[model samples]
Target: MSALTAPHLNRWLIRLHRPALFVWTVVLLGLGSALMCLWGPLADASAEAWQQHYACAPTGPCLYDQAAILRYKHIYDYATMAVLAVPFLVAAWTGAALIGRELEQRTAQLAWTQGLTPTRWLLSKLTLPAALVTAGTGLLVLLHHGMWWASEGRIGSAKSWYDPPTFYAGGPITVALALAGLFAGAFAGVLLRRSLAALGAAVVAVGALWAGVHQALPHLWTPVTGVSSLESDLPVGNGVDVSTGLLTADGERLPDPFCGSTINPQCERLYDRLGAVSWYHDYHPLSHYWPLQLTASAIVLAVAALLALAAFRVTAVRTRGLS
Candidate 1:
């Protein structure tokens, strides 16, 4: 039999996954609606409450609706969490439904026996899922960025651009991360060939990768170091601080001088004695955000490519009879 063309393979894959595809479509539509709602009415409410919070002045002694301000913060945090959780959900689904269940049920053998090479079978499995995952996650991140920016300068907004969730969920890095999760999950499924086990392990693997990225993120870009007077607050630029503290008179870095309070006489003496601190700090500035994010995304996508290669290699070798 002639080898099946890519279009035929894609059609077969879609037919096989019609149920899953339908569910995902419904889920995405619901999420998209929620995102639009957040951008409109939610944003309006949050902005109003935030303005009220800042309107209070010492001379005016005004009272603001604390509940409304708190509600805005809660909505922002939870919405961010929902977007950030996409990778984990993709990883679990990939490990279980995409590959593991196929292996566990031995249905993959039917495709191979039908003159479909193992390589083609595996490629078909990964390609459609990868495209759908990348597109879905990309859309979510784009929506997240819109919502994040809407509340950014608002007084009561609790989200920080440099926070781990916000940083990864609000940029192109998010698409790269979702791809990584898919590849990692596919690898686990092929290796373990047990649906439940692969699902659990795939999630764990993705979580570990996420943690590693967060820890190494600051170092991904070279940091700027600077010094200032002891009296000045730590310089917070567009970027987040990797490390920051006061320096002694002799250029030695000191632990933060928790001198109790600025009003305390002792606190004043110690701060003054610290004597013109070269307030040293290492940080990625706002300008560094994209560079660092893109660098990290490239690394993650490279790793995902490697994982894909490995999956193809293993699938072909183990089912060499079909090859």
Candidate 2:
């Protein structure tokens, strides 16, 4: 059995998952091709649509090709979603096929009886899938970064850099996120040891992780503050406005007395009475993107590492007790 030794276990694992490998290969190639097209034709098409929108809507109802706009939008949306969903996919498979099913079927115990240590088996499962998730998500993240860079000033409908989905897919964090999903799934499998339960638990875990990040993201970076006189138009800047309010001459912040264009006469007089002078905006400039992305990635990868450790330790203890 030297030909089928532990060192060759990864190969066996890959062979066992040939269909998953095929699907991942197809997905990567397809996504890469789609992104490449988006950098060129899709971007051009969307720009033209925006141009037509502006031209047609200048003084009359727009008659431009709404279908073209929608199609480009659909393409971009699907691409973003495909990249963002990689983590959950990893989690589901890891929970269902990697650890959960092996435990549920007692197959992992059989492997242990044949000389594979529980720790080694768990490591093998985590390592193979972690490598695949890292490579796959890394490629997609690079593609998205390139696409975003190439289409920055060109595509009118491309989301802002700090937009949650854009931030999620356009940086190194996506790779870390996929790894986290793998680890989370493994941990759930180890904890639950039931395929369906583990699957559900892992998905919920990843979703909670995502939601937590989304909530904390806006606060991760310090925002640049700008003040505009109440009579002036709001300053046009490309940044995420976290908070906006009217600032009194004494520097106290209060809700806009103008109440966002309703133009309450009483509120207007109250604004003059309270000495509210300017509208202030607290926002993150485009330059803050990397800081937020990296910080978030660091947090996620750290959590993933903890989960991986927990999985190994828990399994080691459980299997030792079983013996």
**Number of the top candidate by lDDT?**
2
lDDT of residue 142 for candidate 2? 91
Clashing pairs in 1: 239-286
Worst 10 residues of 1 by lDDT: 229-238
lDDT per residue for candidate 2 within 1-323, as digits (tens), equals 22234666678788878988898889999998888777778777777877787777467677776676677778878998999999998889889888899899997887677667788888877776787789888989998888888778766777878777887888987788788889989999998999889998888889898888778877887888887756554633557667887887778988644454215566567667777877888888888888878988898999899989999988988989543
* Model 1 ranges off by over 4 Å: 1-6, 56-71, 232-238, 248-276
TM-scores vs. true structure, each candidate: 0.87, 0.89
**Predictions: Cα RMSD each:** 3.0, 2.7
Per-residue lDDT for 171 in model 2? Answer: 91
Ten-residue region with minimum lDDT total, candidate 2: 256-265
Total clashing pairs for each candidate: 1, 0
